[model samples]
Target: MADERLIAALDFHTMEDVQKLVAELGDSVSYYKVGMELFYSVGAPVVTWLRQQGKDVFLDLKLHDIPNTAAGGICSLMRLGATMLNVHASGGYTMMKTAVDRMHAEADKMGIKCPKLIAVTVLTSINQEDWEGLGQAIQIKSAVVRYAKLAKKAGLDGVVASAQEAALIREACGDDFLIVTPGIRPAGSDTNDQSRVVTPAEALSNGASHLVVGRPIYAADNPVLAAENIIKEMENVK
Candidate 1:
């Protein structure tokens, strides 16, 4: 069986690596995040391939540009058929709203189902020290919450945030707003570059709608088993 909430992050740079991993993971993962590295390497066809395999995609380009440029990018990417896509919440309200409106309008014109647009609140890899180093006055958790609220107000479907802030975002944005949490490490797994990592069960219990897992699954000796174990952990959340 596949777990839709468990989004495997395809961080590989080659199509061969992606194909091999997806084949190995099989039904344990029903969703995937095709981030900038993979997308830049393999291009839109990777998204097409994922859809062909009956898997949902979160196209993680994290578009951040001027209003018109970002909206144009969204309109273009929407044709790739990803289940979800996102912009940077820091792109501000008008940019986010313009992207959302244009995306919906483009989908309507094309007669295709619009991808659920989201916003990146803050990278999960940024911790307190890193945040403070950037000369940011507000705390990381507070900033994440503010971004989540701004995203919702801008008409986005939700946000890409750390599971650590899931409970807060849920409280502020309500139950329906999607909080796609990355930096998910299973118990005893290495955190790697993710600074705000959480266990699968903890993320779900903290109100994360989806969990994007990378190293714990893909970097494991047996990727399929790792993914299944994480899925089991997610299923056990209560």
Candidate 2:
């Protein structure tokens, strides 16, 4: 199914809203990202509930802390059975490696599916000018490439980045390493807060293993139809 490549960004406030969307979209979208906002509000139960509903959950916590803390957090998050987990690539190789090693160890012991250990190279909302404001001389592409390498060295399965940088990441990290691209906007949709955005087709064609579409699908007038259309666009590229 086309939705296999589509991850619906469930940026809702309440679990009720999550349920409503799940019932509405049905299996057209199986992967749902429970990001920081919703995660903070609902917690691990939400991840459990999503799995109970037969959906794959991408726990987008973007954990970034000391290696020990991050590893502990990964172990806890793993118990919840998330399909994917992410940490900040900027957390350095040690932190990311710590998460990966701990996650694998815990998953093996628990005998459950080990979540894809991914890293966030850079948030899609960060643009060149915005980056410059941070007083960093590193170019956006340079930073993404650097982060991708760090993620690879850390033994991560992939990196979350903009599709605009998907090819660069793919070339650097190789084909097996996952590239889940967020900040995806269908043609003519509002850019919203994302400084870097691309259409579903463009993202898939550029080597994105999956697309995380939030506003474009969830915020649409007819969410199911919108999601279906986007999925069509995603499949046609292949």
Candidate 3:
């Protein structure tokens, strides 16, 4: 279904909002991303609850730390039964590889499937000027491509990047690597705080394997209809 391409971002601050969204949009979108705010407030129980409702959960803590510590964190999160997870590409190759290796080992020990290890290339909230200020010499698109290449070299499944960079990332990393794009807004929807944004069709056509949509759907007058409209937009491509 087109819903497979739409991973509704559960960026709520409380469990009540999460529950309402789940109940309202159940089965319309199979994948749900439990980002920092919700995760910090509710913890693993939320992941368990989402799974119980038959939804695939993406535990997006964006783990980044020393090699050993990051590895341990990934192992722990994998045991939570997440379908996808992320680590910062800027964390360096050793940290990413260590996390990937440890995740595989732990999953094997528990006889469980490991989630796709996606690297966070850059936050969509940032712009080219932001990168330049941070001492990054290249433009935003070039930096994203460089990071995606590094992640692939470190054996990551894919990367989390802005939809605007999806095509560049795919060109640099090839078709096999996954590109999970966030900052997606439907036509006429407010961009909010997201600086790098694209429509559902634009993202998918640009080679994004999945799109994380939050406020555009959740904050809408009718979330179900909003989600349905997005699915229609995605399906209209190609």
lDDT of each: 0.94, 0.91, 0.91
For model 2, what is the alpha-carbon lDDT of residue 139? 92
Q: Regarding lDDT, does 1 or 2 come out ahead?
A: 1
What value of lDDT does candidate 2 attain over all alpha carbons? 0.91
Off by over 4 Å in 1: none
lDDT of 3 by residue, 50-161 (tens): 9888889888999989999999998888888889999999999999999998898888888888789989999999988887899988889988899999999989999999
Cα shift from native, residue 140, model 2 (Å): 0.4
Model 1: worst 10 consecutive residues (lDDT sum) = 229-238
Model 1: colliding residue pairs:
none
Q: After superposing candidate 2 on the true structure, give the runs of residues whose Cα lies further than 4 Å from its correct spot.
A: none
Tens-digit lDDT string for candidate 2 (151-229): 9998999999999999999999899989999999989999989999999999999999999999887788899999999
| Winning candidate number (lDDT) | 1
lDDT per residue for candidate 1 within 203-236, as digits (tens), equals 9999999999988888899999888888888888
